[model samples]
Target: EGFLHRWSSARLMGRRSPSQRKRDDCESSGEDFDEDDEDDTENEPDTRKRKGGARRPGGGRRCPCGPTGCQRLVNETGFRLPANPERRLAWLQCWYPPDSVPEKYLEKKQFRVHECHFPADAIELKEFKKSGQVVRSVKKDRLPDVPFAQIRPAATDQPRPARGERQTREAADATRSELDRIREWVQHGVETEDLPQGSMEVLTAALAQGQQERDKHLRTKERLERTEKRLSQILSERDERERALRAEVRAPQAGVRGMNALSYARFCTDRWLKKSMSQWLFFDAVEQLNAYALLLDGYYPLADITFVPRQRAKKTVPPADGERAEMRRARVNYPQNRKPALALTPRDALVFWLFVTRSGMTLSRAGALFHISRGTAASCYVTMTEYQLQILRREFPRLSAQQIRDAIPDRFRKFAKQQGVKSDIGHILDGFEKQFECPRDDEVRAACWSSYKHLYTVKFLLGMLSSGAHYFTSRGNPGSVTDPDQVETSGFLDLLDEGIDTMVDKGFLVQESIQKRGCICWMPPKMRQNQKEATAEEADDTASIARIRIFVEHAVLRIKEWGWFSSRQSLSIQQADLHSDVVFIIAMLSNWRAPLIA
Candidate 1:
């Protein structure tokens, strides 16, 4: 340092010794210094004082101890310097004993780290004589006065933010503070009593609004579904009402009003509206009904009963909301109300009734036949059926063995009468299946589906006298029912005498029950693969039974001549309902007609 000072003083005074004079000559010579190498000398890093700090005239400012801020830190902070001056900036925190009391700090120069460094890792560790636990040395709380630029500002600086931005920043700071507290609690088991302040209300309100919006959309969807259902129901009701009104308006033009041949010819022009004049009036088969109604007089009204043209809607018109129709329609009356307040003569009624029965026409067609609506046709049929049954009930008393035996006509009773044996008179028994209804459910379909008929049907136990007339009909039951069960429940056994002969088909399974009641049931022989051949007597008996049982088929055919029995039914039920009455009426009508076979 003293040599450097002397050199600086001599350079300033322009006085130089011999060694310096030689050095100056060599440095200034062009032979020693190349022109290209001058830039290298200018750009090289120097250990001299930097330019930013306050610089004095003498080379650079000196520290309070001697020259640099580093030297002052070394002297005051008890850090020992290396023996060689070149090694001064190479050491980091290399200090001596700090046991002595601190001396007064120098006011002129501030201490700072020139090149901060740490020790390198050593693979070989030195063992201490102390315990196994390793306690590291701690650092002091305060640091020496260092002249770092961040510690002393060269220029005054202040931040600028908008009002909203400022508030947001403050909120962020508060959140960060809370997070720091939570982190401290997690890491060091530390906690704070109060939560950080921020706007949780705004977030909760926004969430609630979104939830309400979603619920509103859901409610709107449900309401729309309900409205759609109601509209569809209303539309269906409107269509039905329109159809009823149309039928009412068009009913009056259907039938021609007269008994003369001209009126009959005019009505027969459209064959679908009424039966043809040749088939109804000129036909000999149906002419007897008019004579019979005349012969029976007041006892039989089936061929002469009449009904006014009633509007179909009058029966089933929907009541207006909160109010009922003034006249609640009454049910059809049978024997008491056979005659309409105003109607055609008995001859016209007979022609219409026979035409409908023989033609197998629908009730709708029956309505068109006599200038009436469907409702009027239904009422007429219902009343006529009841009246006919009431008359027969009076004429034919409850059947006893003697009466049933006596009912056989000339052809069937001839053999028994000639043989002088009532037991020879036979009653044929069989089951007839009629179309019932369609089932909607899978289970219902399985139950109602008939393996025999290959369709839905209702089964009935039918009996026909040897005279080819219907004797009795057990109420209709499910097609799946066993024939023997119907035989047991029909109460026909009660009317049988000690030796009544009943003929039946092979499928009837009721042969044993008839025998138990002391009645003989003749069924056709059944051939099984393993069974022995039947004797000639069994074969003859089977053939004879089949011949006699065929009359049951004829009787059933006569009943099915009505379209009501032949057409598909709207509902399925057993023998106990209104459907049973319909079957009962059909059986009675079959007996009323001429014998089926001859």
Candidate 2:
């Protein structure tokens, strides 16, 4: 029956389903199968249908190929499961039949064998079966068996008594006792029995002493404050007194104007006017004028006028009889006498001299002093002063003419020379010639005396020792000197030349080499000295020179102090000489009134 059954099952399994048949044919030819055909067959049973419509004689129908079922077999040997039919047949064509059987049955058989091969370990089996029981037993053992009622805290375990409460009660009792003691003490007063009688006395004495010390400190502070106030008051008063004394000392000297007679008066008057002059104008003006006059008289003299002309001229005519006779005749025929025109009234001249004596007074002050207007004063003063200076230079010779030509620089000298013009010395002598005809013998003699006297003044002003009383003892008998004779006999040019050389030799004037040529250089003496010799002594000498040189400056300044020298109109020779004479007189007066040393 087994043989028959196996054979019948193989026969039944040999038949292919309609889809399998189609799939096999398609695989053999490498054709595509319709995917819809597989879907249509999905509901169909996975059973093989035999050919000739016969049923196989098996308990269940199986594939005829058995382990090598024809329906599962692909062409030749191998096979692949079809995909959704399009490339399915092509894919299956490359497959070969399996080399071994599938492991599904083997895996199931091996699992069954594994299960039967060994039982679980005895310990594991026991633990798996008794786990719950053991867990219950452990939970029961870990838990306490005490009754719920016994778990409550005993009444004895509740807070017993607090010692603080007891202590507080005791403290309250003690405090009550203390209060009773305090009340007793308050009612009876603290007993001094514990303290010694001497101690109490000592305490009382200390308290008294402290109170006294405080009182003493208060009194001291009060006294100190009073002393400070007093000191401050004293200081304030002292300061006031000091200020008053200073004011008194520094108060501008009452009417004693010094070198600045006119200017000081004007300044005081102006100051007084600004301060309180509405009520004191006339008084102040008179005071100022009087103060100015006082200063003038103190520093200036009235008998100091000496008239000299700008030029000393000598007449010329041909000599007769013999050469000497002809020369003498020529000399006699020549006009000799010349004098200044417009002589200053003695008062007017004195007023002007006084005005120039003060350092700061100008022509305007002279006008005020003489009651002349400023313009008239200035014009007359300049003209007269210039003429007088010229005359002084001509007659005195020592005073020296201050020619503007001296101010011309060497650069201009070259230009002057190019233009056929001479240097300053030449120009000055030429100008002298044009202004003055010539000097006569008598006039020349007078000039010599005048020059000697003027030289004395210059030496005195320059702080040089005068040739002394012995030399000038007899004013009428001036020593007849060849130098003076030469100056007298020579022309004005000769005198100028001699004067220039003498001044240069005296170190009062300097000559500089300009472009290899000599020219006059006017500078302070100190500036001309050796640099290394500029010591204190040299400085003092320079200062002395500077101080005395102010007289020379003042002589020049006086001419400017009066405004006449700056007149536009040409002055007559006599008037010019008179002006020069005024300058000479003023300069002489300044020297005369200058402070004399014993």
Candidate 3:
């Protein structure tokens, strides 16, 4: 007891422990110790060593002295409090004497000390402890400064329940914590009662703001829920409509329009065909349709109905000179037993194909309209489309240079004269865009996105003669490609002959390319960067180009007039492979219309 008392007194007076004094003496005397010396030191008193036989520092462990017993050590040593509020209070309680410990700190639960650090500025700790002064009493009634806000714990701190349960618990916990904090702040403010004037007004304003924020959050949440409900309802309605339509398609029909020639002719009148011509026939006149059908029948195999004449039963007869008659012998050997059928006649099939092409309707709808199975309709449609496209491709017109010159009206010559150029424009060229569905592929999507159309599109170059006939249509390219790139790649330049002049829109920057091809390109002059407006000569040139180029646009309008191209539902991703063929067909058909220039 006496030795322990003397050691504690020495430590309080800033004197080194006996073990530390001996170690310093050994280090200063240049003495070398072996492993045995370290073993011997473990037996020494006041030697704070761990189980590994390593000596711990003096301040490494928590103080053995109770909170009230070591007040003098804390105040005299000038140690700063811990940064954490709870930790700081517990530390102070451990150091201060029972009478001197603050009353507010006494309410906190006891905290276990894990480790302690010596203050960096405690170099004079021994000097200050040696000349100890009277210790001051800690303020007993002062409140511990608690933060008004805290970050919510991370959700990843523990495994979460289901989504709904987690959300409900988090919201409840947040509300409770906020309310508790506000109540504590109010209590603290009341107890302190030392706030400056106008403090109550600030508190009231803060409370009102918090309330308003909570209400706003609630309103936003409600609005989101309602929007989700409405979207779900819309999806359900769409699904129901689809189901109903499918049921209607599966339903049997007693008799349908346009199933046979008689019904087709009766139901498809000029007025009715006119009303539906753009979507069904491309021609309003029945006579024109019949003529086209007859022309197609010559190429297409087999008629819809064939009348096999019945022969009267004749007695067996042999040819003279022992040579059997060929017709009589074949009739005796082969018998005609195939039955004639009447579901879709060649003319009606042509109309069906046109309807499918123009309307772009599903095969099922076309089959239902014609009182035939979907497979049969598809077969007929494919057959007719191939046959019709083959015939149309051959008939598509092209004007020679001489024909173009002869077709040019007087107005074009007047405009060319005004622009100081010869009135010998052979053809006009322009690019047209058709919107299509966005591609899912990253590279393909980027290629097809058009800044001009502000959509995913495919662009085609159309060439027209002075007479406004669509003489050529280049294959489709991605919309991102420029007009000149399409022109250079689409083989449109191949059609140009030396000395022939071509008119184009201002978008085409193909003057150099055309010059290389031994052809002259006439397009509007662009204003210089430094010049705001075009000069008088440039203005006349632009006006003349516009007048001549207007026909190309009219030709494009005729192509767009097809109901398939005019519909709101643009080209879909599935049709990407066939888009070139379809556009080419449409461009060719546009030439059948009356000449726009004449």
Highest TM-score: which candidate?
3
What CA root-mean-square deviation does each model show from the true structure? 37.7, 50.8, 23.1
The lDDT of each candidate is 0.55, 0.37, 0.65
Stretches of candidate 2 above 4 Å error? 1-346, 356-359, 390-598
What are the per-residue Cα lDDT tens digits for candidate 1 across 1-598? Answer: 9999998997898675444444567788844645565566555544344453434455433232222223322223232223333343222223322332112221222332322211222112344668665332112222223443333343335553465663467766765665555666657744333323333443344457679999999999999999999999999999998886566434554333432222233443545434544344323332444455554456764344555553233334554533433323344233322433544334444455545544556656565656655665555555555555566556545566776666665655554454355654557877677766766677766766778888876777777766676666677676677778778888766656666677777777877777887877656888777879877877876765566566777777766655556654533343225455556656765565566656
Question: Better model by lDDT, 1 or 3?
Answer: 3
Candidate that scores best on lDDT: 3
The better candidate by lDDT, 2 or 3, is 3
Model 1, CA-based lDDT? 0.55
Error of 2 at 27 (Å): 84
Cα RMSD of predicted structure 1: 37.7
Q: For each candidate, what TM-score against the reference?
A: 0.44, 0.19, 0.51
Ranking of models by lDDT: 3, 1, 2
